[model samples]
Target: MAVEIDTSAFTEEAYELLSELEDSLLELEERPTDIELISRVFRAMHTIKGSGAMFGFDEVAKFTHEVETVFDMARSGTLPVTKALIDLTLAARDQIRSILDASRGGPPADQDNANRIISGLRALAPQKGGAAATETKAAAAPKADAEGPHVYRVRFEPKPEIFSSGTNPLLLLNELRDMGQCRVVAITNTLPSLEELDPERCYTHWEIFLTTTQGENAIRDVFIFVEDDCTLNVRLLTREEEQEDAEPKKLGEILLERGDINEEALGKALTPLGDRLVNAGVVSADKVRAALTEQRVVQEQKQQQTKAAEVDAVVRVPSTKLDKLVNLVGELVTVQARLNQISGRLNNQHLQLVAEEIERLTGELRDNTMSIRMLAIGSTFNKFKRLVRDLSTELGKQMELTTAGADTELDKTVIDQLNDPLVHIIRNSIDHGIEKPEVRKAIGKPLVGQIHLSAVHSGTSVLIQVKDDGKGLDAQLLRRKAVEKGLLSPDAVLTDQEAFMLIFGAGFSTAEKITNVSGRGVGMDVVRKSIESLRGTIDVQSELGKGTTITLKLPLTLAIIEGLLVGVNHDYFVLPLAAVEECVELSPKDIANSHGRRIVNVRGEIVPFIRIRERFAMDGERPIIEQIVIANVDGRRVGFGVDTVVGQHQTVIKNLGGSFQYSDEFSGATILGDGTVALLLDLARMVRYVEMQETKETGGA
Candidate 1:
C-alpha cells in the first residue's frame, strides 16, 4: 500500500518524529544493548526517511539515513553498543532535530556540528559486513515509488475575509502546481457588482483539475492548512465514472448511516415524554423512574471515569505549585483556628459542629497536599552511580558507590535544591577523601575505594551522609591552611573536630595541587552555605587514615515545621522538635561544679550545652533552677537552657524579612494562635556561635 504524504502535514508530524528520536536516545543510556530498543530506534528513523521523501523534507531523510545504518549494524550483532556509540547517536539525534526544527523556519542548522555528528556516525559503520550496500538499497526504494500519473479535481473557496487574514491565496495555488500537472479556473458567481465590491473581501473561488499519481489524500492535503476556515474538496474522476451524475453525501447523512442515532428515537426523545410515557403505559411509572435513576447513575459513573483518566494522564507538576497550594492551606488552617475559637465562646452547637468539620477537612487537605509533593530521594541518589562511574574512569581510579536508606522521602522541592550540594560533596569525597587505587593497594587496603551515600528520616528531618573509605582529612594541614587564610589564629587551640571543620572556611584548601575534579577550594564553602540556607547542618567525622563521613541533617520541608516552643524571658521561641533530645534542670550547685565551663554532667557523661538566654543576649538574670534543653546537632549533643518548655506546635515557618535577615540565630518566625510571633531557632547557626565563643575564650587565655 502507498500513502500520500503532504508537505503541510510534515511540519507537525516531523516534530513528533524527532521528539521520539530524542526520547529514544535518552533511553539508550539505561538499556544500551537491548535489541528491542535498538530496533525501535531504527524503525523510527526508517519511518522519518520514508515520510520525508513522500513530502519534501529530503534533507532530513538524507541525514538520518547514515545514523540509521550504524544502528542497523548493531541490530545485526556485528557491532556492540559501546558508550562511545551511544554518545555519538545522541549527538546525531540532536542534529536530526536541529535539521527538522530549521524546516519550520527556526534558526539555521550549524554545518560544523552536523559534520561532526556525521563523522561520529561514519566511525560506527561495519568494517566487513555489507552494511553500506544494505543502506544504499533502502535509500533507492522511495525513488521507484514516486513514478505514476493520476488525475485529481480540486475546488477551493477562500473565506470572505481571507485577504484580511493575511493569507496569500496565490501562494497556495502555486504550491499546488509545484507537485505535478495543474490547471486553475476561477468562479465569479459570488462577486458583487462594481459599486458594492469590497477589495478587502475575497469573493471568488476556484475549480482546478490536475493529473498526478500522488493519490487523493495528497491533493486534499495541499489544502489542509486552509481547510478549517475555507471550503475545499478534492475528487478523482475516470472516464467511466464521468458518464454518470452523482453528488457527494452530506455530513448528516454519513452520521445516520453509521448508526449513531435513528430518526424515530430522536423524534420520540425530543417530545414531552414524561407525562406521555406515564399515560400510554408504554413504560410503567415505577419502571420509568427506575430507568431514569439507572441512567443518571451510569452518567455519573462515566463522569467519574473520565475524571480519573484525566488525572492519570496528567504530567507531574513542579513542587513550586504544591508549595503555593500548601501555603494557601496553611492560611486556611489559621482561619479555621480563628473560627474554632469564636465558636467555642459562642456556645452555638450548629456553628461549633460546622467549625469542627471544617477543621477536620482543612487538616486532611493539608496532609494530602503535602504528601503529593513528597518523593523518594532514591531518584536523586541513583544519579550518583553514573557520576561515580564516569568520574572514576576519568581519574583512573576504582571507586564503587553504595547507597542505603533510599526509601526515605522528602519534599520534591527540597530534593531539587539538594542535588547540586550533594553532587559537590560526592565529588569532593571521590577526589580528596578517597585515596588513589595504587596508594590504597600499597597501604594493604582494598584496591576498590567505596563511597556510601545514605539517607534516613530522623523525626521531621532527613539525615543524609556521604562517607568514603580512604585517607581522612589531615588535621595539621587543614589547620595550617586555615591559619594562612586568616580563618583561624596561628596559635589557636582546637580539637580535632574543630580543625576538620576549618575545611569549610572560605579560601582554605589543603589539596597540594589543583586538579579538574575539585581542588580550587570552592565546593566545600558552597556545600556549607547551601546546607545552612536550607536550615540544615553538616558535620565531618574522620580518623587519620581510615575514612571520613560528612553528614547532613535537613528538614523534610522548608514550608512547615514541627516545633517545640519554649519561653525565654517571657517570650516564646520555636525550636525544631527533631533536634530536641532531652531537657535537664541546671541547679546553682551543678553550675558551680562546672567552674564556668559550658559542659554539663548528664547521666555520668559530659555533654556540652548552651543557654538560649545568653546566646540571644537577653538582659535578665539567669533563672535559679534553669532548664537545659539538650538536643543533638550533627551527632553532637548540645543543650539550650530556657526558663520553661511550652508544648509542641505545628508551626508554619515564615521568613523573618530583610530587617531580621542578618540575624543567623533565628531562621524564621511563626505566629502563634494568640497573634504573637515566635522566632524559630537556627540550630546550625547556634552551633557555629558556640564554636566561635569557644575560640574567642581560648585565645584570651
Candidate 2:
C-alpha cells in the first residue's frame, strides 16, 4: 500500500524557513563578516530546497536553488556578503514567498520581478574581487575548521508494531544516506515462518555503518520524531578504533558493577583460588560464561554513550495543543478550588487533606502549562529590523534601530497581538518622530537618527518601550492640534501627561502635511485601541529638544495572572498582583483630615486615590476604617479603597464578552472558589477615568 504525503505541511515549513532566511540575510548585512550568520542562511535555504523537492514543490525547489547557489558562493568565500547581496537576497526571499503562495493556488507572481531578482543574484557571482567583494579568500572558508568526517556505527531496530504506525524505515535510511557514505545490513533474527507471518508487522531491522561530516547531531536528527518508536544505537567507530587497547574487565569486576557480586566474592573470583574452585567442581563454567557475556554487552553499550549524549531532547508541540492543555488545567484548578471550599464547609479532615494535595499539584500544573506558552519576545523584536530598514529608506531618513532585552518573555498570544501596535509605533517614529537627515545635521545632531526598542519584566507585566532620538513631541503644538480637531474644549487646561495622551484620541494628527507613513491620524488611535484590547496601557513621554518614549505595560499572560482579590459591599474585584504594592487602613479621621480631597498622605508622599464604592456609585455604607490598596498606576502610586482584602488568587481570566467591551472599570473577570465571579479591575484606565472625572468637576466649579 502507498502512503500519501502532505504537501501543505512542507509549504508551511518552507514559509517559516524563508522568514528566518530573510532575518539572517538582514543580520548578515549588518555583521557582514559573521560566518555563522552566513552558514545559517545557507542551511535554511538548503532545507527548503531539499524538503521542497521531496514534497513535490519542484518549482519552489528550483527557485530556492537559485537563491541557495548565491549563498553557496558566500559559504565558499567566492562571493562576499555585501549590502547589494543582502538586498538582492531579501528580494529573492520575497520572490520565493510569492512563488510559494502562487503554488498554493493563490495569485500568480510576476515573472518579470522573479527574473530580475534572479538576474541580480547571478550578477553577484562574477564580482569575486570587484565592488561586491570585501574580504580575502582565506577569510571566507572558515568551515575548514571542521576536522574531518567522523565514522559512526548505527544499529536501528523498529518494534514489530512500527508498521502499524505507518513509518517507512527505509525512508529514514535513505535520508541518512543523503548525509554521507553509508552501508546497511538487514537483520532478521525474529522473522516468523511464512505461513504464520503477519504482513502488517515490521519483522526485519538493519545495522547501518555511516560516515558523515555533519557529526552525530545530524545523524540523530534523522530519527528525532520516531526515536521512542524504535531502538536506536549510534556509536563513534573512530573513537572505538582509536581506543583499540581498551582492556576487557574481569568477570568479577563486571558482576560487582552490576551489584550481583560483592567485594568478597570478587576478590575470591579474581585469584587462582577461584579457578581452583571452578576446577574442583565448586562452580560451573556456564555461570562464569554468562557473566562474561553480560559484561561484553555492557561494554558495547558504554561505547555507544558518546554519540547518544550529544542529542538534545526537544519536541516541537503545536501551540493549539498547549492551549488545550492549559484550558484543561484551568478547569481542574476551578474544580480543585470548589473541592477545597466544600471540604472547609463540611469540616471533613480526610476530604480537606485530599483537597490540599490537589491544590498544591494543581498550582504546579498550572505553572508548568503557562511556561509552555511563554516565548521570548526577541523573535518579535527581530522582525522590526526589516521594518526599520525599509521604512527608513522610504522616508529618506537615515535612522538605525538598536534593541536591548530582547530575551524578555511574554505569553505567545500577547506577542502575536502585540506585533501590529508595535509596527504602528515604529512607523510613527520613522515618519513623524524622526527628523530628516539634513534637518538633524542642521540642529547639531548626527545625520543618522536612532530608534531604540526594548522590553523588560516589571512584576507580572512586560514593559516595551519604543524610543526615538529625533524630533520630540511639541506639547504646545499637540494642545493646539487637540483643539483644532474638536477633541477637547478650546479653553481646556491640560497637564503635560494629559496633553501627550491626546495623541491617542481619534482623528489626532500633528503632521504639517499628509504622507503615506502616517498623516491621516488613524494609526496612533488604532495603536491605542489595539493595546487596550490586550488589557495593556501605553504612556508617552517627550522633551521638546530631547526625544519621545512610548512605554507599553502589558500582562505577562492573558490566560492566567497573579491577582490580589478585594471586596466592596457585595462585589469583589481583582487587582493584578504586579500592580499592587501594599495595603493600609484609611481611617475615617484620615478622610476627615483630607476634607473633600481624594489624595492621601502615605509616608510623607501625597498620593491620589479612588474610593471604589464612590467611583462605581454602589449603594453601601462606608466602613469606619477601610483597607486601601496602594498600587502603582502607570508609574504613580494610587490608593484603591476596599472594604476588606481577600488575599492572593491565581486568576484565570475570563472575558466579560462584548457587553463590557467599552467599560473602563473592569478589564475582565474570573471565577472564585465559592462560585462567584469577580471582576478584574483595569487600574490604569480606572485611574485615568477617576482623574478625568475630577478634572471635569473642577472645571465645572
Candidate 1 at residue 287, lDDT?
34
RMSD of 1: 19.6
Candidate 2 Cα outliers beyond 4 Å, as residue runs: 1-3, 31-36, 101-112, 123-312, 596-607
| Candidate 1 lDDT score relative to the true structure | 0.74
Pick out the ten consecutive residues of candidate 2 with the lowest summed lDDT: 130-139
- Candidate 1 per-residue lDDT, tens place, 602-628, comes to 999898887888877887877798888
Residue 358 lDDT, candidate 1, scale 0-100? 94
Provide backbone clash counts, one per model.
1, 0
What residue pairs are clashing in model 1? Answer: 150-212
Q: Candidate 2: lDDT over CA atoms?
A: 0.80
Which candidate achieves the best TM-score against the true structure?
Answer: 2
The per-residue C-alpha lDDT of model 2 at residue 177 equals 80
Model 2 residue 251 CA deviation (Å) reads 28
TM-score of 1: 0.62
